[model samples]
Target: MKKIMFNDKFSLTQAVLEGRKTMTRRIVTYPLKFRGVNVAGYFVCKRPSGEVTEICMYDEDERMIDGGQILPKYKVGEVVAIAQSYKDLGYDPDSLDRDPKDLGIRGFMKHSAGWNNKMFVSAAACKKHIRITGVKCERLQDISEAECLKEGIEEHLKGIQYGFPSNIGYIGQYPFSNPREAFSALIDKVSGKGMFASNPYVFVYEFKLID
Candidate 1:
């Protein structure tokens, strides 16, 4: 099992808290080439149709290294903790301030707040948990509308079904007309300019809230 952190601004942690988000994607940072190889000693595997895909790597004994897994950081049925402050954890909903001395918190203060304060909550103090259901890799631009919806992009937009009686829906942040576009905007905002358009390799995690 592993613990994953989320920033407060993107509302991803919020979406998980609300049980609206069931999936997320993270860019692969390390190059895949290996010795005498291209990126990080990894062999590139592709489907017969020319579509790039992941491979199941094994040694001479037929035993797999990394157990033939990449990204997602967690395996199926493994529990993960969310790194956000929550009211359910005895923190005041209005203030939600954390004390830096709590032994459970292991975060180092980077640029977020006071130099001695914890930048994020500890895994033990996290009020939400999730279980990984599946994992995959894909090009950033290939995400479909359904997949974007699965990322909970719609949760950030206002709509009639969301209890806004006015018929007017808000699409303020990214101002995109669809979930896929909104998702693209979100990736750009978080990663950097032109990131989504660059079509980097990304790890997609399918999960369900367990806490």
Candidate 2:
């Protein structure tokens, strides 16, 4: 089994637990003098041997950049644990049948009193697990309109969108205008500042909660 973590600030972990978020993306950069593409292009590229394939990145100016191997941490169909903070675990030390044991907190001491970071949470303690259903490579900005929603971009909708009764056209009011822009802001927070502007290559993983 593998482990995947999300930011608590954005309530992403909560979203996954509620079955709202089904996909995630992680950036991959070419070390030293390597960089990359836009409008979320997808191309089927084959190497000279016709055995290897890769997605080429393009800059804003439309110049092609060769992105080195885009490797993913988890594979399709693999079961992965969704990490959670110890405080979020709902652990009741007083109610447990057994005595207190190491919960895998990094600086945890018997007398210490603080919540454990999600990264330190052990596999056995993970209450939520997801199974990878799909994986693909794409540039950060290449995300589709639908993909943005899958990334768990929060949307607050006002009723009566475009004077129509349908719920599909409601405008989002979650600080940002719509899903893609909101997702751009989110990736930067998750990855780092300027990551969205750089439009780096990324591995997108689609998954579903199993527990």
Candidate 3:
């Protein structure tokens, strides 16, 4: 699979409208803190052909509320039409109509409707140091949203080294302002360091949220 790279100058909304599927390259350009609030960031998606699209909260909402700004190097309108073509073909993630939470914190919910799981570690440790801190596979067939959270918390407590047992005692028990913040904090804790380290990539796993 091709890796996604960030294009500081692109407009995610225009790319989606042009019909280009967003690539999977994601980054955090700023010092983002998961304060259990509704925070957002930009991500870069790499097309199969190696072209990069910088998709962000702007693509889904048409505005940036988190003090983020578009990169000045790339032209926002240059790839609008090409991106629109991708959208016309139904390749956009935003068009799926599911709540962002339903997509899972790291887009892992798409693989298993019953349970979602992910692990994060240094890229160098991907094979050896990578750890699966959370798992939600206890009851795949009839899981409630509350139960899913409980399983995640249990897994975190079992595998993670810090923060999990101290801050979050049980799944779905934290008073996060939003799911994103809670998920972000979990990623940080599991990674055993800050989230934007040059050599680390947090593995994200997610399961379908039962209605």
**Best-fitting candidate, measured by lDDT?**
2
Full-model lDDT for every candidate: 0.61, 0.65, 0.28
Candidate 3 per-residue lDDT over residues 1-211, each given as its tens digit: 1111112123322332232213211222433433444445533322121222222233234444334432222221222111112222233343333223332344432332212221111122111111112221111223343433332322234323344434433322343533334434443454334552333321122212111
Model 3 lDDT, full chain set: 0.28
In TM-score terms, candidate 1 sits at: 0.64
What TM-score would you give candidate 2 relative to the actual structure? 0.68
Give lDDT tens digits, candidate 1, residues 55-166.
Answer: 4444444544444444445566678887654433445433424445444333532322322222345566566789888776777887888888777676343455546554
Q: 2 or 3: which has the higher lDDT?
A: 2
In model 3, where do residues sit more than 4 Å from their true spots? 1-45, 49-173, 196-211
TM-score (C-alpha) between model 3 and the true structure: 0.19
Ranking by TM-score: 2, 1, 3
Give candidate 3's error at residue 52 in angstroms.
15
lDDT score, candidate 1 = 0.61
Q: Rank by lDDT, descending?
A: 2, 1, 3
Q: How do the predictions measure up, each by TM-score? A: 0.64, 0.68, 0.19
> lDDT score, residue 27, model 3?
29
